[model samples]
Target: MVQQTDLAIAPRTAMGRAVKHLRQQGIIPANIYGHGQPSVAVQVDALAFDRLRRAKNTRNFLTLRMPDGPNQTALVRHVQSDAISGQTLHIDFFRVDLQERLAVKIPLKVTGESYAVKNLDGVLLHLLDALEVECKAEEMVEYIDVDISSLNEMDDIIHAKDIKLPANYTLATDPEEPVIKVSPPRAAALPEEEVQVAAPEAGTPEQTPIAGE
Candidate 1:
């Protein structure tokens, strides 16, 4: 079962430019909408939200506890941040139905050392970083681990079709897609000293005579 994280939220009356005041007071304005439900404007503690975001997988379901309404199960859909200051500007929570299967992108974590890379001097290339998968909210995984230890020779590849999924999980990505590969080591540039210029043969016209001769 997917782990659940809880966050306390409250209804927000601020809108437009007025929402700036909420941020000034260390509150984050947010919206919750999904499953064909009307969007709800809400507010949450900035510090608390930051901690939750840094500590947990944002893709995991979040239990939003509201002061007046019933608790909501949501996914942290999006977060808008200031490009310069890196401050959280706004957040969007997508409410989910635990019983329904949903498609979400799960990060692909590369694990285990590749023997080709360690001993054969091969270069390991990570072609894909995430996989799109469909699974019930209750069965969603934090991330999928892709072991590269199977890569024992150059040109060895791990394709999406080779990935094993948990029960009830189905891949949304194309099976032919290459996820990772071990490539032959890059060719090293020749050193300047190794770049030979043929010298003129001893009696050739192209040879220059010695100054004293």
Candidate 2:
């Protein structure tokens, strides 16, 4: 089951350029909308939201506590950031129905050592980093593990269909797509002296001798 964390938020009246003042005071402007409900403008403490974002599992459901309204269960839909400074600019909270299934992308983590990579000096290629899955809010997961121990030879691959998901989770990605693979080790380059010695001299018969000496 997914874990839930409490986040305190309050309705905001700031809009457009005026909201920058809130950020100057260490508060972030945000919105809450979903389930055919009217969108709400809100704000949260920058430090608190930062802590929640840096938490172990970013996929956790957030219990938005409001002083004037009942608590709401929401998912972080999007976080806008300043490209150069990497500062949080805005946030979007998506309210969800706990019992209703929703599609979301979950990260994929490579687990277990591959025999081909450990013993054969092969390269491991991770083709997919995340998978889209459909599941109820309560069934959400932080990440799915893809074990590679079964890859014993170069060129061996693991496809999406091979992944085993948790109960109540259904894959939304193509099953036949390759997720990971092992590639043969690259050949070492020969020494310059070896190449020079292996080549024929300029006057050697191997080269078409001057037409009619």
Give the clashing pairs for model 1. Answer: none
Off by over 4 Å in 2: 187-213
Write down the lDDT of every candidate, Cα atoms only.
0.90, 0.90
Of candidate 2, the 10-residue stretch with the lowest lDDT total is: 188-197
**What's the TM for model 1?**
0.86
Q: Scored by Cα lDDT, where does model 1 land?
A: 0.90
**Which lDDT tens digits does candidate 2 get at residues 61-114?**
899999999999999999999999878999999998899899998889999999
* Best-performing candidate as measured by lDDT: 1
RMSD of each: 4.2, 5.1
| Candidate 1: clashing residue pairs, number | 0
